[model samples]
Structure formats: C-alpha cells, structure tokens
Target: MPVPELVRPAPPPTRPGLALPRPAAFACTGVLLGLFLVGSTTPSPMYALYQQRWHFSAIVLTEVFAVYAVAILAALLLFGSLSDHVGRRPVLLAAVVVEIVAMAALGFAPNVGWLFAGRVLQGLATGVATSAISGALLDFQPPGSNRGPLVNGVASGVGMAVGSVLAGALVQYAPGPTLTSYLVLIAAFALSLLGVLAMPEPVPHRRPLRDALRPQRPTVPAGRGRTFALLATTMLASWTVGGMFMSLGPSVAKGLVADAPYVVGGLTVAALAGVGGITQLVLSSWSGRRAVRVAAPLMIAGLAGVAASVLVGSAAVFFAAAVVLGVGWGLMFMGGFRMLTGLATPEHRAGTSAMIYVVAYLSASVPSVALGTVSTVFGLTAATLAFAITAAAFSLVAALATLGHR
Candidate 1:
C-alpha cells in the first residue's frame, strides 16, 4: 500500500530543467577561460603587422600592450568579486558579450587608435571574467579534488600558445590574416555564450548587486601577509617572464632569424607557453612550495641562457632557453596559484584571485613598457639583456624569500 502511494512518479520533478552536469560545467568553464587568453594573445603575432601598417615606434607598441594590462587592473579592482555577490553566470555572460565586441574592434580596425580601444575592451572583458571563471572552477571542483589551480595554470599557458601559433599561421598563409583569427575567436565566443547560459550558477546566495559594485582594495586574509608576500613575489617573477615573451618574443625571434617566416614569431611564444603547459601537467603532483623553490633557480639559469642566446644570435639556443624558461614558468605558476587559492576561503576566493592577478598584470605591464622604451633607445639586444638581469635578480630574491619564510 505504501509502495502504491509512492508510485505517482513524484510529480515529474519540478526543478525547471537539468543544470549542466558538474563535469561538463567544469570543462566548459575551463575552455571559456582559455578562450579569453587566446583572444588576448591572438593579437601578439599581429603586432608586427600593425607596426608595419602604422609605422609606430617600439615604445608605442609596448604602450598598446601596457594599456591592455592597465585596463585589466582597473576592471579587476572594481569588479573582481562581483560574481560572489551577483552570481557567476550573469557576470560571465556580460563579459563574454563585451569580449566579442572587442574582437570585432580589433579585427576590423582601420587605425592604431582603434587597436588601443579594442585592447582596452578586451582587457576589461578578461579582467571581469578571470575572477568569476577561476572562482567557478573552485566551486565546481569535484569533491576531494585539487585540479582547479592546475587547470588555471595549464589553460593560461596552453591558450596563449594556441593563440600565438594559430594567429601566426593565419597571418603567414591565410587571406585576411588580420581578420581571420579574430573572426574565428568571435565565433568561438558566440558558442561560449551558449555554454555560459546553460552553466549552473555556483553562488547559492547572492548579496545585493549595488553594494558589490563598490570598488574594493585587494587584500589577503589576516595573518597571511608573509605567505601572501611570498606568493606575490613568485607570481611577479613568473608572470613577468610571460609578459616579456608575449610582448616581445616574436620580435626577438625575428631578430635572431632574419629570414624566418611569420610562423617563427608564433613559435617563439609557443615554445615558452606550450612547453610550460606540458610542464605543469607533468609536475602537478609536486607541492606548491617545493615547486617554487625549484622553479626560481631554473628561471635564473634560463634567463642567463636567454641573454646569451641573444648575444650570440643563435635561434637554436634561444628556443632551448625558452623551453627552460617554460618549465620554470609552468612550475612557478602552478605552485603559486595553488598556494594563492589555499589562502582564500570560499567566501573570498574571487577577490583573492584578483589580488594575485593585480600583482601579475602589474609585473607584466610596467616592466614590459620599460623594456620597450629601453629597446627604442638602446636596441632590442641591450633591452633584452637588461630584462634578463632584472628578471634573474627577482627570481633570486623570490627564492631567497621563499626559503627565509619558514
């Protein structure tokens, strides 16, 4: 009798429709995050093309790059934790739409001013999406799993690599080199919008949107200042390397191999990013602190190798040094991110993630702009040597600090 009473099929389960399965959601979120980076770097291979078309100075080129980083910092400071209050899906959806507009601006632009405008838009979109997407990965992570940071690290490096390589090939071989890559990105983002629409909102109880919109200063949890400082140091060192490669690797490659095809520029970036991605996966089992300790020295050595490669004009040596740098970059990123995420509770995950990126993009932007200016005045080789020395010194300090901190 009881069984018969329960046989009414439970009213067809009125839950409004199934949410995207957690596994699917996790994968989709990762892919969307990667797409954002891909969009950012897709312009890297084309910077030379832009310079050729516009006759801009190296300083101007770096300014264009620096502007993007500044916009990202502005957005990150303002909207970093917004998703924690208003829910992830809405924030992500809006950002993606903005990203599509940015791609269009870059792809169809008639002048350098439009390029600057497009980069600012793209940077805003990326900054808004970064915290939300990274937070979503943490929210959707499988129970007892620690894959969130790994995914973030790997996605970043791999995405940049794919963007650079794909754009390079398109520029070298495709008809509409400047337009094709961004069009592809536009279409990819359009599909990502659908995925975001379907993604389940991970934030269960959202706060008031107006209050969340207030700009918040970046902060670490109380009593974690030393840990935060160490992590910041590591991030600064690692991401600065990334910044340099992304902004100037192609140009450096061209300098080394004068007759190489456009694809070499992309390969210059891919060597660092692609190898870094693989290194992260291979070293996923290592502890964060240990990875950083090991990575710092490797980075120092790699920087020395890079400087030597430039001095000798050896493309082979440059690529090899890039691989070394990639390994160091991958380990430091993975380790530092793991530590960074550990510093946050679920309540403040997005804000904390934003703070680390603030450090990262700052390192990426300021020094890169300086390097560009130096290149304009001193020459690329001299600028690169200075960059190498500075980066190596930072790496040493980071390692020493990490060791001294307990």
Candidate 2:
C-alpha cells in the first residue's frame, strides 16, 4: 500500500494581529489533549463521595462511569474523521466548549441525573477533542517524525495521573469536595478554548461534511489480523487493570486503612496513573515487542499483589500493587499502540488506530460495570479477588500470544 502524503489544510487567511507560531500550536495541541483526559478522570475520586451523598449502589456508580465511555465510543464512531473534513480547530473549539458546559453541570449538579448528563457531555467532548488533537499533532509534526504517538500516550497518561492526584488532594482539604475540582478544571479548559482558537489550521482543504461523517467500520489491514488481535488482547489486559483501579481502588484503600485521608482515593489512582505516565516517557525508545514481553509478568505480578492486598486488607500492599499495575499499564498501552502504528498503512492508520481505542475503551468500560455488580452481590473483597484473577488471566494470555507472534 502506498503511503499518502500527510494531508495539511491551507492556512486560513491571515487575520488581524498576532498569530501563534507553528511550534506554539503544536505545544498548545498537546496541552489541550492533556487537559481533555484530565477532565475525563477528574470525577473518579468524587464517585465515592457521590455514592455517599446519594446513597446509591455500586451498580449505580459503575453505570455513571459507563455512560461516559458509551458516549465516547459513539462520538468516536461518528466523528472520528470529522476534523479531517471540517478542520481541527472548529471541532476542537466545539469540544472545549462542550467540556466547559459539562464541568459546569457537574459543579452545580443537584442529583444523580445531573451527574449523568455532565458525564455524557464530558465523554462526547473528550471523544471529539481526542481525535482532532491527535490528528493535529501528526499534521504539525515534522515530516517522517515518529514522536506523535509517543506524545499522545504521554500526554494522556500524565493528564489522567495529574487530574486524579489533583482532585484527590482538593477533595481531602478543600471546602467543597465535589465542587472544587470541577471549578479548577473549568478554569483550565477555558484557557484551552482560547488556545484552540489560536492554533494553526493545518488541513489545506475542507472535505464535504457529509462525506467525512460517513461511517467507516473499523477494519484491519490484510495479513495483520493476528497482530491486531494480539495488540487488542494486551490492551484489554492493560485497561482492565486500569478500570479496576480507577473505579474501585479508592474504596479498597479506604477499607484497608481506616481513617485514611480523603485524598487516599485520589492518591491510589495517582500512584498507578503517575507511574504509568512516567514509564511511557522513560521507555519511549524500547521496541514494542520488548515492551509487551516485559509487561505481561509485571501486570500478572501486580494483579497478584492486588489479590494479596484484598486478602490481607492491607493498604500498603494495595498501593504497592498499584505501582506494579501502573508500570504494566504504561508498557502495555505504549507497546500495543506502537505495534499497531507499525502495522498500519497511511490510509489505514487512522481507522486502525481508532479500532485499537474502541477495544481499549470497551475494555475500560464494560468490565467496570460487571465488577461493580459483582461487588454489590459479593463483598468488595470477593469482587476484587475475582477482578484480579481475571485480569491476571488476560495478562498471561496476552503474554503467550506475544511470544507466539513472530
């Protein structure tokens, strides 16, 4: 398959005064991507608080989280390529605006309904913004540069880690546990909106809106099915670990450490996410295959630690497991993405990449709901033990598959 030239839109006519330099636009897009992920994870720490206040069940909490994932999957399928047609700036600007609204809704939420609405909007905003920003980064990257995916992975991981930690700290110490985090996010996103406006339009020609919106089902390139499947499996394993930690790690932490700091929940997520982010940056140079090979045991070990933590009801062990989980999550994500990137032709790249995320998000979302339901039926300990065993099983499967792959 022939590689298509990187499509760049003609720069919009120079308007009045200052225009952002190309480098600034690149940096701004990176910042925007980070901000989007941060907003997506900001609510994780608050879920426990919401459950406490509303007297809702664990099933309800997972449903709330699952709504965001559903919306994001819908948006990605519908508008994954929209920016390539209408331009990144417009799509990104609209996404930012939607996020602001979502944040406001969450900040002022009076009931569970409001939280659902806010999360749905947040998912939509993130889904739309993620594609555009990712595409924009590639567009702005120097021709033949391979740093775009690295940047994307790092930015997202950092954003999620930072958001979790920040919200956790604020929830513990701030006057309004629910309100304060959204307020801070609102301010950050507001600035990102301006940054989008100032970003350079990189697509040279606008394709028809109808054409761009046409649904292209996710497809793997010929002879790459095994490779795609392997990546997908690894991603599923990686995301399962993440989903468990993000959704229930805090509750588990609280159980183990009575009188735990309110920030403990956030700290739990931050530890996993923060280490994951740093791992991606540090191992950016490793071969994708090597990364995957290393990740399998790390994840399995981490999951074992998690199971141990639950059995003993130890906070210290839980946190220690989180660190191992973080390392595994980082490696699995970057390695799987890099493998996919290597397999895709230029024309097939976007679609292939989208499919990987579809799998990734599905892994992240559906399992959380299942685990939550299990937690409701069996105890949290029982549910967590089940989750760890299942996640470890997947990791072993992924490792075996990776080894079998040429």
**TM-score to true structure, per model:** 0.90, 0.93
The lDDT of each candidate is 0.81, 0.80
Candidate 1 lDDT at 106 equals: 96
lDDT of 2 by residue, 1-406 (tens): 0011122333344223447876677788888888888887788878888889999888788888888887887777788888888888899989999999999999999999999999999988888888788788887665567666667877888888788878888888898989999999889988777888887787767888999888757768779887778767877888877777778777888778766355788788788877888898898899878888899889889889989988987888988988998898888877766676677787776667667767877888889999999999998898899899999888888777777554
In terms of lDDT, the best-performing candidate is 1
lDDT of 1: 0.81
Worst 10 residues of 2 by lDDT: 1-10
List runs of model 2 lying over 4 Å from the truth: 1-18
RMSD in Å for all candidates: 7.9, 3.7
Q: Residue 37 of model 1: what lDDT?
A: 80
The lDDT of model 2 is 0.80
